[model samples]
Target: MKVRHYILLVLVLFTGTLFAADIRFTASVSKTEVGTGEPFEITFSVNANIERFGAPAFNGFQVVSGPNQSSSMTSINGNTSMSMSLSYDLVGVKEGEYTIGPATIVAGGKTYHSNAVKIKVVKGRAVQQNTQSPSAGGNAPAVSSAPSADLSKSLFIKAVASKTNVYQGEQITVSYKLYTSVNLVDNALDKLPDFNGFWSQEIKNNSQRVDWTIENYKGVSYHVATLKQIILFPERSGNLVLDPLSMTFLVRRAVASNDIFDQMFGGGSYQDEKYKASSAPVTIHVKPLPENGKPADFQGAVGTFAIQTAVDKSSLKANEALNYTVKVTGAGNLKLLNAPKMNFPEGMEKYDPKVTDNILESEKGVTGSREYKFLLIPRKEGNYTIAPMKFSYFNPATQRYMSLSSEPYTIKVAKGDPGTNVTAFSGANEQEANLLKKDIAGIKTGAPDLYKDEEAFYGSVGYWLLILIGPLAFIGARLFRKQQAENNKDQVKLKWKNANKIAAKHLAIAGKQLQAGDKKAFYEAVYKGLYGYLSDKLNISAADLNQQNIAEQLQLRQVDAVLISRLTDTLNLCEMARYAPVTGISEQEVFDKARSIINDIETHA
Candidate 1:
């Protein structure tokens, strides 16, 4: 019996060791060396079922095709084997040596890692002589008899700049274009260029479809279309480099075949091929503006501009308000231009000017006008003069600083009527003045005539009644005070009182998350803000809050239908944005919407 038990134990141990030995994980690549624009493949293989997989970040490379997965199981004799792999196709952007990081996988309650791979990228074309296999998980042609087409000759991207050299804060237009000779079925931008040391504004097209035109380049006629256009303003003086723009295209190619079997099976001699193209990096030389002859009022304006000033009324009462308007019109960085300062006469009070920008941006640059309106109130009656307003800007065309001045204005002020009292105080002082005036006017008038009764005694009914009512009023006041103290201790009432303050704190957190580009955390914060606000305001538990329940509760509070609908929609969006793919909705837009809903609820609910 003891020998049989030992044999069973030995078999169990042997089987466990064999299973452990069968588990294998590794990473492999199709090639270790390639040209700058040539494509390559990397694959990760595992022998056991995987519960999760984390892909490595492929820095300095653009992914052309994604994580294509395949699995298979084979059995021979009395043994069985299973294998799975994840593959990716990538293209290099620049010539350099790069390392592909290791990938991690979790299987059978154990973690596994693949080895890192090193690759060398050089200049020149790395010709792929053999056709790619059909199971390589790509959209390219499976088989072809003729050699592959030269990508540089068939398709390419060009970067054109309106000005290669510019002064700091000057506007320059850069456009990316696509030129192709082959038939293209689909195209998409894989990566956008980094515009370092510059502020960029995209010029949006009204229509989605691009207008293609025929163009001649290098003695060849190719169809060309503008892919993107942007207006860039250099933030500093230096040789700023615009990184290359990467894109992928699906080209339709005609396959050549001579086999009779190919024709008999109707294997159409046409296939869709995948290719990638990139624009050359562009260098911009930015020169600083000349300090000589620069105006003292120059506030970083780098364009031609004209300033005009006008007073609404030349003559007005001393205590009346007048509008002093300064309008600036012309082109070049209008949004960044500061408001020109004005010199007003002494004893004249002026408030901060309200600025309005009616600006439009295009490929040519920023255009339109900005208006500044100042409210002036004269304290004493006199003739006042507002000095000429000066605006200085650097003109790139003329390569010199220019200044624009507006005509001076003279205003006549007369003392206001004493009967119509005009106090210089603001807010509560004005209210207090009216109250005091009314009280004085009432005292100046004689008191009303009095009628006395014939009988006057301490035991009269009216006197006794007044004495009894006073004690009863005091008792009622004490009870009301006690009730108010108890209500102050209630947790629900406390939360309701501070609901807005709490919501504001959460919204502030959400703003930080948005600025950091943390989509998941941002949405979560917004959700918490809305939920916590509504629960506290309505005295509802957080667990019981939902779209339907919130709507019902808001309706009970007599909230407006439009406001309720907005709240519901905003909450739904917050929930969906947590898991949905990133959309065109901007972080600012979400923040503004959430803020508006909360304000509306506070006002109407």
Candidate 2:
């Protein structure tokens, strides 16, 4: 009788499980055809109750409008179920027919997929204009149609340089302006262009809406916008290319209608307009300075500038050194532009110069000066002559190159003082240093013999006793904690307690590599995706580590051997590829291998 009762209970539970799994879910898109830069909506809905829902990854399209969610519960004849829906306003990049989605979600221990919907996005209908004037109210009078103010017709970017022609190493102020005559709702800026081969400075970044004013551009008046401005210093003397900066903005187009109300609201229709405006990649005719006229010490710098020299102190003791400041201040790419070459006097020790810049922007463009501070020390006591300095740059406004020079200064020497110089200056305070050194040497150094009378038992029972007790004590404490947790009956609390241990143990190996600058090791551990699987995975600091630290951190994370080895190899290759002596086919092969290892570890681990 008891056996039959157990069998009956088992059968009832199996039936319940099957009944719970019977819930079904389905979702599909309305249409798939889309025009370039047109907004469309995609919906994901479920037909049955779900414990949780999620959206699938949408790779190609951007969610411009929404991920609006809705939930509803309906009851019919005392039977009830709930459904959830999610929708997004998406935009395609180009005109095409696309398989919108089979969006998926996992809930109630089962996976559900939405229907795969196809969409065709074709070119939009032609816009028609109404020629009736507003004054022709009662008796409509025909008026010849003319294009109104449409900002969409002329949206562009312009690169305005202070001067297109310059000598080598001269500074050029480049400003990017966005001009549009179209009505706009919103616009998104794309990725910025790379200013390669030029030492550039971001002097101004406009983050506020520019107050627009009417300006006559080439005999036509239009509303103009100033987007970005920068100061560029030409590093290499050649025809360097400046790439185009592109952006996408919502362009508002008015709908032409005979009805005044329709023209007001439906004219509010908007479309995404991509603006790829840039000035022609400028070709500056860079002129090289004449060989005979150029100064032998000239370091290829050409610009208009002036210089001044000053000394912090003219009189100093024998061992003491004084500061000599040679300042060159003027306007001409002062940020990108380098100052004249400074020559250190004979027998003077100098460290790296501490550079400081204070630049501001104006209608004249970015103007600033760089100050180089040098820390100098004199070798011996003597008078020194600091030579006069010179600087040169081409003035874009004047269309000619200019130069600046500073006057020379002299220094006097006397007896040394400790405060004036760190090295070479010896005073009466030197005796205090000797007394402290003697005191430090007069101390005992040896391990203490605290256990002299205790019995030393090795390779005996006592050694084994200690080794066994250590693990036993740990096990006892763990078991006690487990028992306490079970009594409390808190699963989430228990998960939190053990999470760090498991995470740290797994991340130990990787953590070591991360600290040691091992890029391969760092990325490999990050790719492991263990953090998503095991709660106790180590918390690895992924910042500021070089390739060597990356590998060592992996070991520190205590990652498994197979993963660690692969990580180390990948890290080493990344480092080598970045700083390798030879750059060719082998470098590409190594990079490919590293990427493969990263993906393999991510998926398999």
Candidate 3:
């Protein structure tokens, strides 16, 4: 009886083992060994009731195409089971023998893995070509909700600039153009690049819809549209990079469906596909203008231009004011060009000139007119000549220095009011004037006006009370609103308000770890805590905080240079200790340095 019981127990245990391991995963490759530049498929077939599934990270080989997924469910013997599969087309960028991983996924609260496989990629193909690959994690093609046609192979974009090299403060115009050889069904923007290290002004964009023109590019005819235009002025002389612009478009393609019979029955189907591409980034080398041959009146203006002046009334009464208008207009650096200074005669009271800009940007360059209106009041009646206004600019097209001067204007003033008479006081010297007023006594003290000083009101009490209370009430209300905002602040608001304070707390924790001789934990704590603090303080993501990005952002915020360098050095030291495994740095030294760095950054930032 005991032997029988043992046999039954063994059978039960074996059956349970099979039942527990029911979830199965199988993987297969289209070709195990292929020549270089050859494409093949790797499919992972999952046969189980999967509640959730995740893909494995692919390394060592490029993914030419992606995980096109197909799933199905089947019912057999009143028992249901689901199956799903994903296939990827991969290409080898380099020849090597690579071992793929035992990829794992979780299903039904249990982890299942696919078997490891070896692949041999050989070189010496007939054709030399570059391989295209999908991005990591097998991101699928983006689909658009709007109905549109595909323009992947027919349309493209390019950016054109007026000049690559320019002096500091000189203007440069950059225009984005779209060239289309085929009709576009629809297009939309994916991302807009950032403009760094320059002052930028958007001159034209989609907001202003202009007519499209048919133009020939590289001897090929196409419809061109000016997508965007900007006028940029470099603040510093260096290599300024203009980032790339990307867009996604949906396009329609005609595909043959079924057979002749289906076409006759009007059963043909058309499909729309989407493609995304980015324009190449442009780098410009800005050369500073030579200071040796520089003109003193050169206000950093470049390109060819013209200046003109017109007077509303050249002849007028002595006391009456006349308008002298100067309009400077032409194509070139209009915004950077400076207006000529006006020279007024003695005894003329001239108010500030009202200057207005009416500039428009085009593919050629920046074109505009600057009008300077000067109001001149002549003190004496005589014939006075106002010198011509001069404007100077460097003509890049002509490759020479060009200047323009308006013709001088003569104003005739007749004798009028004694205040405006120049001859009346021409012969009288300052000494004579002092002698004539020698007998006049200086200002004398006098009693105040008693009746004017007294307040006038029908009801003194009400008027004085209202006058004193209105301003007080307004002050009290403002104070109450400020208190309410402070009291109602949530955690996010409080974090932003005292971000530096919280960062100091974490830095202190890192310092303690350093004191305990925990070098690895110390560096990890300092780097992560400090960076995380900055992310919270600056409201930036950790993924985007590289050295250039951090420096650019902090410099724009007017952060001090010493603090920036200290923070950069501290981060570098942490990385070196982790990666290089050089002579181990002292924990106490790094701790103090980290504390000081954080303090300095917070103080300056």
Task: Look at candidate 3 and give me any clashing residue pairs.
Answer: 149-250, 149-251, 149-252, 150-251, 150-252
| C-alpha-based local distance difference test score of model 2 | 0.53
TM-score of each: 0.48, 0.43, 0.42
Candidate 3 off by > 4 Å: 1-155, 162-173, 179-185, 197-226, 231-236, 254-256, 263-267, 356-360, 381-383, 418-605
Q: Which candidate achieves the best lDDT against the true structure?
A: 1
* Candidate 1 residue pairs in clash (backbone atoms < 3 Å): none
Pairwise lDDT winner, candidates 1 and 3: 1
Which candidate model has the greater TM-score, 2 or 3?
Answer: 2
Please report, as a residue range, the 10-residue window in candidate 2 with the lowest summed lDDT.
128-137
Please, what are the lDDT tens digits per residue for candidate 1 over residues 34-95?
Answer: 77657788889998656568999988776755565544333222123456788887766678
Give Cα-based local distance difference scores for all models. 0.75, 0.53, 0.65
Q: Model 2 over residues 463-526: C-alpha lDDT tens digits?
A: 8898899999999999999998786696555554565444344355445545665544443443
Sort the candidates on lDDT, descending order.
1, 3, 2
Tens-place lDDT digits, model 3, residues 177-263: 766654345556666655555555555321212346768877866666666676776645678787877776555545568789768
Best by TM-score: 1
lDDT of 1: 0.75
